[model samples]
Target: MTVELMATAEHAPHREEFAALYAQVQQFYAQQMRILDADADGGEARWAATFTEDAVVELPLLPAPLRARAGLTHYARAAAERRRRAGSRLHHWVGMLDVRPRPDGTLHTRCSALAHATPPGATSKILYVCVMEDVLVRAHGTWRTAHRRITRDDLA
Candidate 1:
């Protein structure tokens, strides 16, 4: 009976499961960025679809103490709109490097990204470069960002 229980220590299968879950979550993020990039008129609608029904967004104006992911989808949509209206094109995305699971089943993720925007008659500018720190969760088998911290590197 002891010999039969020896296989319990194997973590290979557990590792595979986590990888699959991570990939699924990443796919959702990729789609959200794509929608924001390709969409001209309906970008907000498409981007909002990727978020949880009760998602929050924080702008630079918010007091640090007041910043919270307590349902700021409307504000995020408006911010996206402001960028869209000002530019001919904007592309922003990240390459994930690490993901760790929290005790509550959320994932803490780290990723590097390069963001660029080009106005109609002006040269494209690489406005921001940095790593994104995210708290992610899978709801209904889909990954949603519960929190995001943008650490921009002005020198990058």
Candidate 2:
């Protein structure tokens, strides 16, 4: 069974909630960069922690994990390769989000996403467009992603 240690936070109000939500979103992508960048100082773990005990992630360019362990393993391999190949840098940009509170107190948030990887000698950015759907839970007065899914709109 997956652990719910990361799903404990609360939303005070609209303003406060948005503030927290925005932070979470920003952190989420930052962690992704960490995985790409290989900064293990909690980024990857925190990223995985964002999900629920039995959360799910769907990536068009990747396979869905049967569980968190599998997910982490897949990510580990993907990261190993991505870290190589001399490139300027790869970044993920998150856009306007639509966040809704579920009946069970989990937040369902969706946003337009763009993943850009710039090569060392490339003049253009390779962009990946998708809608990122996330499920966030509030536990122990903290908000973390319980689950996330990236539905690629158009692979580039």
Candidate 1 lDDT over residue span 1-156, tens digit each: 133222321322485666665576577668877876774665666666665665554333455421333234345566677876775678887774466666787877777877788888988888788777777777787787666666667743
* Model 2 error, position 36 (Å): 5.5
Worst 10 residues of 2 by lDDT: 1-10
- Runs with alpha carbons beyond 4 Å of true place in candidate 1: 1-13, 58-72, 121-123
Quote the positional error of residue 85 for candidate 2 in Å.
3.6
- Best candidate per TM-score, number? 1
What are the lDDT figures for the candidates, one per model? 0.63, 0.61
Report the C-alpha displacement of residue 124, candidate 2, in angstroms: 5.0
Candidate 2 lDDT, 1-156, residue by residue in tens: 012212323333455665666676567555654564453444555555545556666677765433563475557556645645453566677766666667787777788878776677876485778888888777666665566677776754
How many pairs of residues collide in model 1?
1
- Candidate 2 yields a Cα-based lDDT of 0.61
